[model samples]
Target: MDSTYDLMEVLNHIDPSELNYQDWINVGMALQHEGYSVDVWDRWSMNDRRYHAGDCEKKWRGFHGAGTPVTGGTIVQYARDQGWTPPYDPGTALDWNDTISTEGVVVDKNWVEGREVTEPRQWDPAKELIKYLETLFEAGENVGYVVKSWKKDEKYLPADKGAYGRTAGQLIELLTQCNGDIGGVLGDYDPEGGAWIRFNPMDGKGAKNDNVTDFKYALVESDSMEIEKQHAIIRELELPVACLVHSGGKSLHAIVRVDAVDYPEYRKRVDYLYEICKKNGLAIDTQNRNPSRLSRMPGVMRGGQKQFIVDTNIGKETWTEWKEWIESINDDLPDPESLDDVWNNLPDLAPILIDGILRQGHKMLIAGPSKAGKSFLQIEMCIAIAEGKKWLNWACSQGKVMYVNLELDRASCLHRFKDVYQALGWEPKNLKNIEIWNLRGKSRPMDKLAPMLIRRAAKKNYIAIIIDPIYKVITGDENSADQMSNFCNQFDKVCTELGVAVIYCHHHSKGSQGGKKSMDRASGSGVFARDPDALIDLIELDTTEELMKQQENKAVCDACRQYLDAHFKWEDDLSQDDLCSSFQMLNYCKEKLDKWQMEALERNIEAAKAKIKSMTAWRIEGTLREFSKFDPVNLWFDYPLHTLDQSGVLGDIQPDAEQAPWQRGSAKNKKNAKNRKIDRKTALEEAIEGSNFGEKPSVNEVAEYLGVSERTVRDRVKEHGGYTIEDGLIQKSDEKQDTGKPD
Candidate 1:
């Protein structure tokens, strides 16, 4: 019996309670015939309620060999009836010691009818040899053959290594020249002992594994089975046989095509071929595993039997096709399920990972242009998930997270995380939940990294895996749809294997992104945007000077209030309006505080000014699959932290590329025109107030301060309509003015 399959595993699949008495006894008989201990049967039978503890031992002792003994195939068939399918994947690379399953059995031995073999009526020895050579080898390749045999333990064996340096073309020419006399071309052979020929092409040297030029055909001969049964099983299995020849003994030599590239591959493929053949009931002769092993030659006589070709090209056209077909038949893919069967008892949906954003075991992409703080946003999300805090406006589930930092050095990446926590004013309470894998210079392609990541994170129970700046590990051309689709599947593999959400960041394409949809802004093929369950795109907002001034004033006022809270008691003396104005706050602090305290306040105000100048505004737009589309969120990237814009200043700002071409110019012109008028009015007022310390300013002085000519300044004062210009002097008008405010 072939031990490639585990009979115990097959027996486990059969429920004893589902089997009748005769069928249950047949299982025991099969196990006993296959040489298993009686204990195996007793343990398996314990599953049935009617099983007696000592019944198996008594039955085992009486199990003598019968005329037609039951075999392990009976248990395999019973398992199949019980809905037990074998687990196997043909596409997976097979190791040398891996157990081969019988999931793809192509032939049923009990029902397979024999395929009869017949002798040729008018035998042509030279023609038969020519056909065999032409089918198995190229014209320029070397062929090894032996005609002499020696008796070894009552069996005829090749006397020595045969002639090695004869090309197939040369032999064919010689055989054709010597018609009707086979011995004239080479040497005479015993009529009772058949000639032997190596199936694979040789390298004009001794016939050994190393001397084989192309690792082509492998011999699949089984002498233990009847000739007719072997023939039937070989064809039914669809072995890619180049030539099927009768050995003129008890077996047929199937020269199955392996088409391996080298020696190691040849060995692996031959092992797989033999295992498949054995599983399908053709017990392969294990000795014929070497590439240069010999098989019976056609047109030869062996013990009164004539060796001849039975068939050619009997199965699949190539080795790869046959292997794929076998794998497809026995793949571990689940069977199609009917919707009606599961409609009432539907499975629960995956739990939310980021509320309103994504689910556990899903994927999300964060895309933006360079220096848009995309990586910082991902790190913030990682922290939020670790602490069960809100990331931006969405709440996150708390758990362990892995931050795969492929674009930063170890120290920089660690420091950045610490710096972000400090900037956000969050304590390091859940530091243990975060795992950082910094692969700055050691990053591999996503396909290669996914397996290593899975192995390390198998039992870690991570809720999310965040990869920062995925361009470092991108596998193929970003522009190719198919290639990028394959590249994105690596994320799917990681998600499926670890059962965690995968979040990564990508950069947007060049040029303004205001016009494109959030999904279209991500650089590269659309697959990058569409493949993820949620896509968050960050585009820069055009910050106006008025908004910047408002931010700076707010920053200075907040800094003053923090300084006063730490240093002095100012709340009792200052009103809300005084604290809100930067000018008024500075005057009050300088008047009431000492020099040292005022110096400290000056430094804080300077830092606040710088922070406001360095700030960049962004708008986050989302495309979600599991939830409804959300309103675009506004954010201020204040260096190391992204704070939500609570002031509503960015609410009216529009992305440069997001607007339609016709609407963009007109809308922008209207907004810019109104802002310009306000800016001109403010500049004139400030200039007039500063000239000569609170006196009506001269037209020349105002123009110089405003960086314009006197005529431009006069026109601006006239346009203001709240101020009058006369005699090279500017003065405020007393009429009830518009004040640039809406009713």
Candidate 2:
């Protein structure tokens, strides 16, 4: 996703809990609905929403310096708002505080030099909760409720009393008359006058004339930068204006007021704007507005015509009411500026918080099959930090977080928050410190945008970014080690520079991880598993119910050869019978399997490095065999290995293949050309074909079929070919050919 995606909001809602966990979730959800990614609550001192919001302002002076002359008021507003009351009184009086200033009883900051008012670093969590609760109230009104309009025959609202029988036009005219200015407002037109002069033998009101009067709105046509040169063209005429970017160029809209056009010189007035536009070289949309037809431009959507946002069958009054409501809310209601002020004041943060965010800052992969809750888990991470709660039910170093959830709506996110918040049962204090970005319905380049967004979200504190599902944002070749490596390397640098943890929720590779390393389990880039400071992999386990079914006889880790000294245990609280508990069992399985996979990957990396070193030694020996001189200074050395490639000593050297230089020059390498050996390509292709592994094979059978050492096969396809095997039929292929034995 692009920087726009970073602007997206977190999806979910908050509740009236004392803990504020749910509220944190609610902020995330709202942002999500609006298309922002957000982090969880970090602490409870500063509120963040206001800080991230927009407002018009003019600074009193230049940037504040460390130590300068300044004015100020009381440190706390509640105390300053009134006198320092005896009970829970503020230490200093608002007016007397030399550093602070007060105006009309409003607290203003003092430009005092060197006066660092270091407040707490927590965000106001209550705001996020309140925001969500407010949304719920709005939602309640929208749910299973309908707005019915008084049809064409009806002219008055059902709520009207004495005037219920009056026509809409009559009501409007009467209401205007009652306003106490008849001549200035109505002129010669009677309170109940004006029959159609032409087609309407009877009077006409917004009667769906179907006349379809095609009138050009906004005259045409300035080309390129000319409009900017003569920018005065836009405001010269009075019309509702809008901005549109067409063909990568900018143009402003001018919607002619329909009501203003009903005059003696109506056609002439309309024609003037049209002629002016044409003279100015602008494109006039002649077919844009059809009088009597509600369809116009986007925002000009009439009442009962604005399909997406307002009611379709709504009467003009209801539409007016809705508009009035929106206007009143937009204009009169001021954001409390509670948590946001605090969140904005916090100092920068480091990334090591929360136990090094899902494993150091490296390209940590959170791999799990679809429906495995990878995204949910990542969001949970956001919640923990934003609220300064625990991660995965465990304590973690906490800080600000930025979650980019390209999936899930704000509403669904709210439901999730409700579930988690109901579980926690408390509202928080410092929710505002957490920042959010809501990005939806966008085709943006994440590589181009993520860094900028990450930088922006790092206000006050460096922000931890968790992209739930790396594939969603990444656009380049996910398989290319170079491209993927560079992509993740950027993140590594960001983590170190901004001191913000970076976590990615990734999908696991297809099939069961019977017994193997799951680095390959990470979706998309292998580098995704390579880059980050650390990585955490997730797995799904059989539930308690499944375990009970197999309770007749079961084996734990060691007994089942999955782990050393691991023992199977049962819990009566969660499980139905002898089976595993639905949630508990799944969690256990995920932990166990996730750890195993991670460990296996670590082992492989170590093995690869060791093998590379050894192979380099071995290759040296072989190179010496070909050289008459011990030092190959006499011969050209074209190993094609840079410092890193040379140092990457791996234990798992190619079976019948060469090491670095060898891999670079072997016949097999030449054939492989663009990338990797044929074997690797064949392996990837095989994987692509398997799609679903279906039934697995025994390890021995697989080792025999592949013609490589069993240990070697385990090193490569451990999860697929090892413990996952069932019978002797180990080899698999795509589009199986018929043997003509059955069917």
Candidate 3:
């Protein structure tokens, strides 16, 4: 089993909550060292969505400062302090040792004392013994050993059981103490059988994983291979083997430090080695291909004889070379298509989500000043979208709408909702497709809140998300491009990944509206305006005319009421019918026109006057006018109703003058009008400079080339005054013109 697997299994079984304080602290230390941060606990708590245990920040304060060391014991202590209990045995909690054979068969050494009185075989350590041992230790491979004994039989000891070594110092000490045969796995040591891995061209150890064994070297093993044969093969392959070792048995192992690709590719190289073995009639031990497989440690005795170092030809190579070698072996691997394939596979875009206002899977921004009815306008659109109705003049693509109001408390949000609902006369049930999240104080940044938002959108099938007051979740310097870009990227992920349209409300920069485009007025970095699919600005309309009209109407109603009160005794006990009769009498007594008298014009006029006066009392009451989405002339929407008649569909209100000075007429016109003066001047200059007719082209030809009218070209020509057109060509008067020369 993999060491990581063993660790995880032990941790999974151990109930942190059940551990004693000290044990929990120890576990925390271990986890911290393993790359899990204290913040992870807080993040995990937030995953459930029902509760927030935000105390983790306080608890882990100052824990990650520089020079702070974390170990298994300290982790356990921290876990205990945090109320986590250890589920595994404390003694072996951090153990990563593999089990090794400790038993050896008993054998008699008797008759040898008298029979072989000859000289006992002498053995001595090599001069490079220490250097060779240091190399293996530095390589971090698991070293195995056969314990020396006075008896003939010996046992192989495993490094994982503390019998061999887990560290360089430990290995040095073991070798010095035992002075016995040393053997180990050529690959890096893990508690598991071996690690399935990949190599990073830049940094091999940088790609460390908690699950797999990390290696700095790769190993290839072959059997029926003598030391000479292994050397020959290494030389033939031009391999960068750090060393080759002769195992006690018939197999020979080649150890190459992994400097290029990871273990997976290294495994392929091992397979290549096997193929070479087959072609050369050299047998290979497939079992030793396992990265964790044990091999003979250099400078160690084999079967009571001094083990020889077969060859040592370590060399330096660039990451580029290793990468090429790794890739070269992958010729047999399947190749997949690239990102261009996706570009080639796309279909044309369909109609926008809400005509020109919004599009599916895109982002929009609704910006305005505070308390400028930005939310009101957004809510109107939300309701319209949910009902599949027209918002002003733009047709809404009906879908589920989610309004997330992070800047408003629940009560305030509901108050606004109630006003809109009452004005629209929509019942609560009619708004079933609209969901509101009044997250005033409970909101996270866009990046942090994406998961929850995605979940809700998926669960409720929301097609659009209205984030009122987008700055509430900005969580960074709004003016900083980098910070804003980070926030925008997260928001875009939500929009594109979930295929939901987003309309986020933002504020206009203070005093930024003068001479600037409506979209440019949005606060923060220009990215706020540039990144959105559509930019809409809501501005408070100047209602001076409406206020004046209301006052004038009030005066008329007061005068009419006073006249009826004084003449007809319009006091207590006066009925509506009586008031109407009195008004008719007053009107009937007016000087009648002779021409209209024959047609009973006086009676009709008196009845009309009476009807007007009768409605005066009720007409002064305020009512919200119906808003329209398509009224480009009047971008401002919804005002109080009045009795005064006007030309507009909704009372006297007209669309405000172009909110964006450059945006006029249809979308095409606006696009064409963008930098229109500058673009035209530049185009005209270029056209004049490129003309080769010894003069400029005719106004008609220039107009056709530029997609402009002849009149426009003529006006430009006159304004410039440097050139004149005669017949069908233009001539510059300063010289004889181009002369039609190739030069």
Candidate 4:
């Protein structure tokens, strides 16, 4: 599909044996559609064993172009699927969203100067062939070579599978004994056409990919560029070449070391080898990807030119070394810069998206357990940014924001925004600045979703992108540090590409999160906590019965005052104590208002009571990278909104799991003796039932479960008359006979 690279060059990358009948025909049709000659198609077809003399010409005549004709792009895509990389101009700059692969780039073809390669002056044909064999194979490895050729339409082709089952050492010894007369050692070859030899060791039978034993060397030959230029790029790229042979034609055959262990790996390595060569201005004949594919023999003659050794062992010594060197130099990481260079003029920091909480072009994660109203909190933040109002306790910069709703349906998500707006008593003046994308059932993993999000929000000028819940879009195992790190990088990509803050919410890990640090509460790997610039964790606070009663009384008083102010002018007449008391306020309202008005006020009072019962308390803890630590923020989740608690009622409440053992004991001490005994009995029963030990629970196990000393467990057992402890185990007195008296 990339027109910069020639179609003919790509065609060589596709192996005919790999394609079915239709696909092979499609390749020919694509070439024909591109205005290429039938002879070109026929010549390439001959590489396949299925080729018939007149098959291509017959297919070519019947090919009338269709309305949507298969263009050369089809062939190009096929080649790419076969691992052909199209040459790209080094001057072209990559777009923000383009994926950059810097691997296997060893040469800057634009700057490399060609190196000259000259033929051997005193050509000893026998010695050249012997050197080629020793450089490529072990002494016992079988060699496959083709000396016999047959003329085909003015071109020489290998007549058959050629000679095989001969050891390299045997051929070397035979050539040495045959003197300068090479024809006596091996079958004779046409004087005009040079002979060819397979680069890899064969199985002593036939020459095919399956017949090759060791997948060591592959041929890199290209005729598209000047011979000297091909030679220079190959060396500059540091291809692990074993033998560099002149083909006695325009191309040079550099037997590069792939060193693959098996057939599949061999194909893979060959593809990688050819891709690097093509990118660096060498157009390789990709059909030579087969492990048993042949290259021109060094000691041979074609017409008037001599096929001799150009150079031997002229690159990196091994395939791995070459590949590592290439990738090490081609990485996109920026070079280190001296701090002294910018000491006087450092760049300004990123602008604040949420004052003291997050910066623009950064990442923030809000973590909480289920029913913590985390999603609602995120929606509130979005509205705050859009209206330039305060989010929770932090002021936000005013700008358009994108809210990605991955957890809720379109209707519910839309209504939630409206509900939150009404709950906050804020006018919807900046509704146009908030855009919601509801993907409840149509969500994809974050890796795939990031680019799509960036593309859509690019022109929207959003200062922040808020993902309501990240669980729906998480890609890999949350427990795997490496995988989760990659998953979190998607957020970084969005922030960097769109220059906006990325704010998302995740559920806290299972069990009580109050005991864990704010950074350790988020579910999965620690990377989730560390990867973000700011981590805000919300833990539920323990609300006592007395606190709930206080909240209910305040709610009722506020409702009564609102009704009296609207229907009767009682505020000026009533004392402050009377107005604040729920009972006094209700009695005053009943005396002044009519029956219908009183009934309406009673309904309002009841609704307020129900709200108090449903409200949940929470504390916000932050781990910030850019700002100093702040005190924990207390809040009340009242249905559709989270309001900061200003009354200090929640300030004294500790997270249930974070309460110290001594604090629990002091609270227990407030109960009467009778109730205290009942509590102890309940604790003993729970410890026995919960213990993993069957039937009779061990005293040590019960003590560990209750977080008490063994002596304390014995006292509790003695107080509970139904249970007895003996031999360090507790059992019901009715179930087990008392043995040698209870300990």
Candidate 5:
């Protein structure tokens, strides 16, 4: 109501021609606020602004003659309701209803009333592709069209034979007819993975021939993506697309227009776009790079879902514009020349933890047959590494270790750890660096467990994480290559991102014992062994049987020697049957030989029995057969044995083969050596701290205090440097300024 009054007052005084665009908008808003509908304003404002030049004059007039106001007929009332009335006689402006008269205006309302709007038709890809080619070449150029289609079951139907000498419109018609019956029409001459694409059409017979086309767009397939996200990416990239289709079931295919001079340029542009999409979390099917890769017809039923059109913001762009878009996004790809500086870069292998057996930023597997005491052995090794002790006879690098027991209950795992702890003479609380996580009851597969464990690993920074029995966490069939590969990649992702070593335990396959190759003995797909940086197989050995066989051979030697002496008559007890009863003499020799054989066999057996008895007294039992990636030769060591002895511990037992240097050390001796180094460092620190600065002590005094050579004391003091030697005596420096030097 207020706007109506205001608009009316303005029309009475102000000329519409005097207003700028903003003033016109203000007037329109006022009229709308006052219930002069948008339809009325639009109807009046449809043509040039000049048309409303006389409207304000017609709506209101003041003092036609002295002291008199003249108003028009009902036209004025109608116009007032519309917030403005035009300047025209009632008979001319209105029919009986006081509405605008179109009698003489010759309004063309039904020019095409019964027909469809014949402007540019909706973008039919089949037609547009032909048009693009024709434009790329010239008029009367040999522009070709190749139409391929698929049957209902996705079986390739016969392609429309090469149609030559066709205009863009004619080709479109041909494709339209094919699309009507079959699933869709493909413009690609060949729609296979490595199709040789060109602009020239080949008869289905000559499709493989190399005929180059002047222009082609790269087809990209991105599946299982959000439409909104796709739109956002397109908007961001501003790519000039030939056509885009929602090609059924979470898949979208795009034909991106590329302005490339040759095949190399085309491929480069396509690869760049693909990488960009990949970097932005778009699951682009990288295999869809060929120019002849087919795309779904825009308006067709594909598996009951429509391969409908998506508005490519720049779909109809000219070659020049498309080229600009390509060049803008195509960064220079990495080349061998660009990597020249990296040619001489040295390999920086991660730090070794147990020489060749273990290292940082890698994964290892320790597998064995059932009841080989592998779990016990692995637990012992883990405890040794965690507590800065040696494992078996091998040196261990000390750090925090986590035991993820996925195959054993908490109580059982604790019991095993307790056994190893008691054997090592360590209190439970002393295992501060070791953590056991019981994941036995939980059924979280690797897919679900990887992220959680990765987060935990990042937080804990454990030097090595031992997942006992890897099968518990693996989700799919281990025999399935696809499943296992994906699972292994996921695991690798975790280890690489976390920068921690992962050690897992696994079981040997049934009847795989005594396999010559240590890896062949592992269960599941070869990936289980192939994927790890290291593999350790703890096998059982038959040391007792072999030792007994050796003893039996020695008995045979003794028996032969005794029989030879008796038969040759070197011993007086072997009389020739008391002076030659020929049968008796033969019986006597045979009897003597038999007696010696039996007696020697018994004696040697008793000796073997005695050795077994001695071994029992020394607590030596079964032996363990060991094989690893670190060494090719198999080794056998005394089992149920303690490696913690500090002295010449290997004196009591024997090895089936020579030991490697890494496997030759005693755990306690290594520990004691490490302790001595620590003690020396500690004593030097004490001597320095206890010395009076006013009476600073010399290196000799420090050496005497720690019971070491002056050179050793001086080296130790220098290694822990925080002081200076002034006049042969060490004194703390008084420097106040921080130079940011390494100490």
Candidate 6:
């Protein structure tokens, strides 16, 4: 066969670590072109690259020189074809034959002692966990592992539990290998969602029993909140102000905790106030920072180790109690309020607008349907946000973007990110602003995920955080509406509480069916759509016109119009005429459908009366008389029925009893009626009942008597709740069954 140039190129570019089957074929083809013969290459790797033919190691040969190709010896050649000579010495062929003969014996031995022989140990999960503990220890970081496999909210590791467990920690470490530094607790800990993470922070602090009562705030980078603007808003709202720099989050979080202890209250009260700031172009940080966890940026010191040079409020009195302080401060301020507020109120892209949004952050919602480009969009977003570019030339919010993907195994995820970074023409996957959350996710349910995600988002100070598919972290059965709603609500709560505008990637549900809107089409409920401040959906208008107009009656874009646009960005490579035809089809079909629906509605009322009448002869006549009175195609403006079917509701469906009395067929199904007979059915059942002699029959006797399969006899026996159909004897369903006859 002629060698392929493309194959050669592929072979040249092959990485041994990930050599695919096609690569092997290319290599084999190349080797063949290079004069190798008699054997095929398979099972390739650095440790075990084969130099033999299929399942016949008897004639296996080794490469004598780096430049020389290996060949299968004469024993295999003789077995395949009689006329063959060894390229090497005759002694080599003889040795090959001997080894070939012995190979069978080895295989035989293995088979004979398969169960009894010592076998190689499989992977021990317990040992895997121990090794991970060593990694932390080697890094001089102290941590602990706790198994809360039952419920998520339960404590991770009891405070008294030691530094780390060998087994459980290894599992966490293995999970880390699957995810990354966002290493999380292992097991199905949560019926809700999240994971438990173990890592001793630089401050040597661990879990504490402090209730975060007043503020349901999330930690972000120092730049998350536009401190100047938010402070001004606090003054305007006459609410409290708090900006704290701690070990908890990436940004120096400014907690605006009011009387709102829960998310709903926060949304109504605090979220409203925050939106006002955002509306006038105020930006806020929304990443997570937790003192109990390790810092995302390794060297970004906290706990007053390093001081800010500019000293905006370097050593200012920290306001732990923002409510009282803000109430006091806002009561009396200078003439035009504050310096920043005065500048912001008179805004036309003013310095105050810049000042309001100076705190940079990125929050993303990486969404797509199954096989619909979720990860592609995520990596693209990461590259763009990382590179500070617009998404497909659309304007984008600024900040380093944090990409947390739970769907991928760690190695694959990193590899994909590498490709994305390269595709974006980036030499390095790491940018100052790009953070990928690969760690701290549990394949099974875990408690650590939710808090861990928020914390990671804050720690990175990512202006935008993109969680792909959203199902990975909040993975309940997203199919259930309530589960879907709760998940949405929880995520919304987390995002809102954290002060991040999270772009949560979600799957758009299946095609519009039965006039369900996009919001209704979501796998979950209105809560999934309601939780997000804004939801952007990729429109999948049916390529075929017959499909698009299928949703003509109720507006497909209704519930979402108030929040998001029903934007259709055509993705077809088809010509303009095709596009026009498609559009026209949608419009035409919709019109046709409207007319059909109106006609159907009127016709259905009469048809229903006819059906009710048909159930009874007189009602059928009455329905026919009413229907006959109307003109066939004329408008039925004065038709009586306005509702679809009141019978479906609690309302009764009354009709002429003489014409529509409940049919005997509907009273009880025939098969069930016979089954309800209980003691008697067919002649066979009666015969079985009378034939009982307090003795069982053999399989052969029963098989002979029934003239059926032994399996059928066994089944019959089993039908009467008996096991071990000895000699194929059967048991009848009737309790009094008896087949009395000597074999």
Ranking by lDDT: 1, 4, 5, 3, 6, 2
Compose the digit string of candidate 5's lDDT tens values, residues 388-501.
Answer: 766655677888888888888889889878777886786565477888888777747776677666655666767778778778888788887778888777667667767878
User: Which tens-of-lDDT digit does each residue in 1-743 have in candidate 3?
Assistant: 12322333344334333233344344444555666667544443342222236545555563553475555444443333333445543333322221211111111111112111111144333323445556544544434332322222233334331123344445566556554433332223221221111211112222222222444455666543344454454444445666665554444566665442456765776566455433333334555565444445545454554444555654335323543554455434457867787887877663467875667777878776765567777777787788887665568888888999888778877777777766666555547888898788888777667656764576677788888887788869999888998888877767865788888888889863534666577788988877777776654433443344543444344444554455455355445553345343334323222344424444444454444433211101111112223222233233211122333432343224533444325544645665585576688877766654444667677777778888877787766666666655655657334555421
TM-score computed on alpha carbons, candidate 5 = 0.37
Q: List TM-scores for all candidates, in order.
A: 0.62, 0.28, 0.41, 0.73, 0.37, 0.26
Best by TM-score: 4
* Model 4 segments more than 4 A misplaced: 1-128, 150-157, 173-181, 191-193, 203-211, 221-236, 245-252, 261-268, 271-287, 301-311, 429-444, 450-462, 665-743
Q: Candidate 2 residues 202-279, lDDT tens each?
A: 122222323212222222322322324223443322223321111112222233322233433435645644544433
Full ranking by TM-score:
4, 1, 3, 5, 2, 6
Cα lDDT of model 6 by residue, 413-439, tens digit = 778767666655546534676777664
Off by over 4 Å in 2: 1-351, 356-363, 424-430, 543-743
Better of 1 and 5 by TM-score: 1
Whole-structure CA lDDT of model 4: 0.86
**Model 3: per-residue Cα lDDT at residue 134:** 60
Model 2, position 440, has a per-residue lDDT of 53
Error in Å for residue 611 of model 6 = 56
Q: What is residue 183's positional error in candidate 4, in angstroms?
A: 3.3
Report residue 662 deviation for candidate 3 (angstroms): 21
| Candidate 6 TM-score over all chains jointly | 0.26
Candidate 3 lDDT (Cα, whole model)? 0.53
Clashing pairs in 1: 514-657, 514-658, 515-657, 515-658
- The weakest ten consecutive residues by lDDT in model 2 span 193-202
